[model samples]
Target: MHIQLVRHATLRVAYKGRTLLVDPMLSLAGELPATVNTPNQRPNPGVELPMPAEEVLGGVDAILITHTHTDHLDEAAVKQLPKHLPIFCQPPDREKLQNHGFEQVIVVESEYVWEGIQLYRTGGRHGTGEIGEKMGPVSGFVLQAEGEPTLYLAGDTIWCEEVEHALKSHRPDVIVPFAGAAHFLVGDPITMTKEDIVQLAQAAPGSQVFVAHMEVWNHCLLSRDELREHLTNNHLSERVQVPQDGEKIEYKR
Candidate 1:
């Protein structure tokens, strides 16, 4: 299996002879405005796409969206992706994608199968307290296919009971956690902080944890250096990988 960090929250994954694009935020750097109610108000997408947009989208068999947030599925992606491509998303986002003119919007309610890949929808809390409640519903996904390693993509969530449950139930071979410690001014981090990441690693010692959603947006406070440093301090660096933008990591099952 292969996974490429295509920028913040966006991932290009290859497994079971199929390529999937997850949460594609394809806008050029500075093309979008900053995230509101955050510390840094600088234009979003602090850096450019490491490769050309075409190259990033090339040979994608399907698209998987965790939610309808602009950062996850932006205007650029809506414009670039082919209308005929099958899109897998939660039920809440079905109407939104249909409104955007996508022809195939498959809602993964609990579980769904496409070709040889099996997708299982899981729950997540975007934040805590009122902020989390207001952030609305979010989801994570588990992918399994014959001759391929099980993969768990924990989308836009902190370390919570739901995540722990997924870890215990799925026992994934690889785990991707969105770890930026992103927050607004009033609330605690809306994404996984360093401590949360550590807890996750400890929870599932056997799974390889890959960090994503860092340093690209104004709201995300945790940088790659900081996360790596924390992991090194905790003696969990060897188990976790923090890839740079457009960097691809390969794994054998």
Candidate 2:
């Protein structure tokens, strides 16, 4: 299987002769308003997409949207992606996408099969207490296919018990964590911190972890440099990857 980091949380997963686009924030820079009260409350995204949206969207067989957050699925994605393409998303986001006029919006509460790939929705806590509640419903996914790497795409979630459970239960070969320590400056991080990354690495020694959701978003406080540095200090540089935009990583097992 191959996964390309388009930008932010957007990724292109290729497996079994098919391609799936995940959390496509397919819009030009500065098109959307800034995230208010955050470190970079300036209009997002702070940088341009590394590749053209059309180029990235090419040949995508399906869409796996973790949630409805604009950073994951922006206005442009809603307008640009083919209306007929099948969209696999969480149950909470079913009506929202349907309202956007998509025809094949499949809500996978537990698991769903597309062609030959398996998609299982996993739980996480966006934040704790009141802040967490305001963050809305979110989900991660565990995908597996014959001859392809078992992938655990951890969505916009911080380090929590559910995360630990997912790691133990799935034992995925490849894991993608939205590891930007994203926060709007009012509350604690809404995503995993550097320490969280270290913990995940220690727990899942066999999993190839990819760190994402940094640099592009205004609220993402942790940079790739910091993440890399921390991991290196902890002797985890070889296991975890912090990919650049438009960079593709392939697992040939």
Candidate 3:
């Protein structure tokens, strides 16, 4: 199995004679607004899509969407993708994905099995408590292919009880989390903090935790180097990884 990180939460997963694109946000700089209902604004700065959405995504057998946020699912990606491609998403995003022309849209219940991959839907909180109300409910996906390692894709969420439940239930070999620590002028922190990540590693002992979603947006304040150092100091460096944009990593059993 080959997993390549393609900026933000976007990724290209190639396995079992198929390529799946997850959370593809392709747009030019200044093309869209930043945060919803906020005066804070900035340029999109564009995405480094592997190829044109129409070209590469045609070969995609499936699309796994974590959420419907613009940063994860852009208008450009929606317009260009083939209508025939099957879309797998949580209940909240099913209607939106189907409305966008995808004929086969499956709303994940407990687990959704496709080909040899078993995907489990786990609950997620957008922020701490009150802040989550503004951000909306979210979910993470735990993916496991026959003989391949299990992966837990922690969507836009903070470290909460639900996340801990997923970790204990799925026991993923790799935990891919959004670690940008995003915040607006109002709330506290919406995303996972560096301390939270360290706690995550400690909670799921022996699991390799991979961090992403940093530095791309101005609101995300955490840095990659700082996270690395924290992990190192905690004697958990080998168990955690922070990949750069376009970088690829594989897990072998």
Candidate 4:
């Protein structure tokens, strides 16, 4: 499988003979406003896309949306993506995508199969307390295909019971966790922190962990350098990979 980090949580994954784009935020840097109630109110997407948006999306076959958050699925994405292409998302987002003129919106409630790939939906908590509640429903996915390694895409979530359960149940060979320690002015981080990544590496000792969702937005406080340093200090540098924007990594069974 080939996975390319397109910036922040967006990924271009080529697996099982299909190219799936995950969480596409296609706007140019600073096109969007800053996230409210957080430090560093600079315009969102602090950096530009490693390549042009069209080039990044050139060969994609489908889209997998973990949630409908603007940072994950933005206005540019809605305008740019082909309406006829299949879009797989959680239940709550089905109508929203349809409303946006998406033609084929598939809701992966628990498990779904499409063109030989198995997609299993899993739960997640975007945050805690009222913020988490306000963040609303979110999901992750476990993807499996013949002759390929199992992959777990842990969506926007912190270290929670649901995430631990997904790790235990799927035992994925490749794990991608959205990490940035993204938080607001008055709450714990909504996304995985460096400490959470360490815990995840320990739990899934055999799985290769790749970190994403860092250094793109103002709310995401954790930088790639900081995360790499933390991993080295914790003796997990070999197990966890912090990929730069547009960097692609290949995995084999």
Candidate 5:
């Protein structure tokens, strides 16, 4: 199995016989407006896309969207993706995607098998307090295929009971965690923080964790350097990966 960690939460996963692009935000840097109050609130995606949109979208058999957040599915992606391609997303975003002129949009409520892979829905908590409730429904996914490693893609979420349940139940071999610690001016962090990363590392021993949703947006508080340093200091650096845009990592089962 191979996975490419594209910018932010966007990535490509290659399993037994399918190539699935997950949460593609293809807009060029500075194209989108600021999402929150920040001194560097010039625009979203503070950095440019590492590769061309076509290159990133190449060989994609399907698309998997955890939610309809702009960072996950931006304007450029919604406009550029082929209308005929299959889009697998959460139940709430089904009608939204359909209204966007997509021909094939499938909602994953619990577990669903598409082609040769098994996709299981895992719950998530985007934040705490009233802010979390306002974030709406988001989901994580556990993907399993014959002769491939089990992968758990943890969408935009902080450390919570839902996450603990996912680790205890699925016990995936690979976990793609959204660890950006993103937040707004008046709310708590909506994503994982350093302590959360440490807790996750401790909870899921031997499971490879890949950090996502960092270093691009203004709202995200954590940086890749700080995350790596903390992990290294804790002697847990090798267990997690901070992959760059377009960087591909292959896992052997």
Candidate 6:
């Protein structure tokens, strides 16, 4: 199996004769609005896309979009992706993507199988009550390919009851969590905190945990070095992996 970490929350996964692009956000620098809301708010200073959108994503079989946030699903990528490519997303998000011109859209449910891979839905919350409602509903995904290791992709979420239930139900071989503890002014940290990641590593015994969605945006509070240190201190360094942008890792089973 080949997994390449492309930037904030974006990944390319290859397994079972298919390559799936998860959340392709390839916007030009300074195109996105400031993620952190404040009195003197500054716009988000976006990073340059490592490669041309088409060349990097040349032969993708499908796309998995967790949500419609601009950072996770940019308009440019949405327009550029082939209309024939199968797009997988939640029901509401499907409506949004469909409007953008994707001809094949799949509304992910609790469980579904597509292209030689099995996808299982895992619940996720964006934030607390009013704050979370403002953010919107989020869902995680568990993907399993025959003869390959199972992987769990935890979308933007904190350590909540629903997430715990999903972990208990299915023990995946790998876990990809959005860390960095992102916050916007008054609300508490919305995404997973460093401590939450430590707990996640403990919960899934022997599972290789890949931490993403950190450092790229201004709102994110944790750094790759800091997370690495925490994992080391807890004696969980071996299990935790923090990949840099444009980095790739392959796992064989």
TM-score per candidate: 0.99, 0.98, 0.91, 0.99, 0.97, 0.95
Worst ten in a row by lDDT for model 4: 51-60
Q: All predictions: root-mean-square deviation over Cα?
A: 0.6, 0.9, 2.2, 0.6, 1.0, 1.6
* Model 1 lDDT-worst window of ten: 244-253
**N/CA/C clash count, model 6:** 0
How does candidate 5 score on lDDT?
0.89
Give the alpha carbon lDDT tens digit for every residue of 1-253 in model 3.
6677777787777766678888877775567756753334665633355445555465678888888888888898788766777788888777778778889998898898888888899988888757789778688999888778788999888899999999999998888888878887777677898988988889999688888777666577788888889888999888888888777888764
lDDT of each: 0.94, 0.91, 0.80, 0.95, 0.89, 0.83
Backbone collision tally, model 4: 0
Score residue 212 of candidate 6 by CA lDDT: 87
lDDT of 5 by residue, 1-253 (tens): 9999889998989988889999999988988888866545768888888888998899999999999999999889989998899999889999999999999998898999988889999999999999999999999999998899999998988999999999999998999999888888877888999889889888999788888888888888799999999999998988888888778899877
Q: Taking the tens digit of each residue's C-alpha lDDT, what string does model 4 give over 187-248?
A: 88999999999999999999999899999999999999999999999999998999999999
State residue 46's C-alpha deviation in candidate 2, in Å: 1.0
- Pairs with backbone N, CA or C atoms under 3 Å apart (clashes), candidate 5: none
Tell me how far the alpha carbon of residue 48 in candidate 6 is from the true structure, in angstroms, after superposition: 1.8
Comparison by lDDT, 3 against 6, better one: 6
User: Residue 4's C-alpha lDDT in candidate 1?
Assistant: 98
What is the alpha-carbon lDDT for the whole of candidate 2?
A: 0.91
Candidate 1 residue 150 C-alpha distance from true site, Å: 0.5
Superposed model 4: Cα runs more than 4 Å off: none
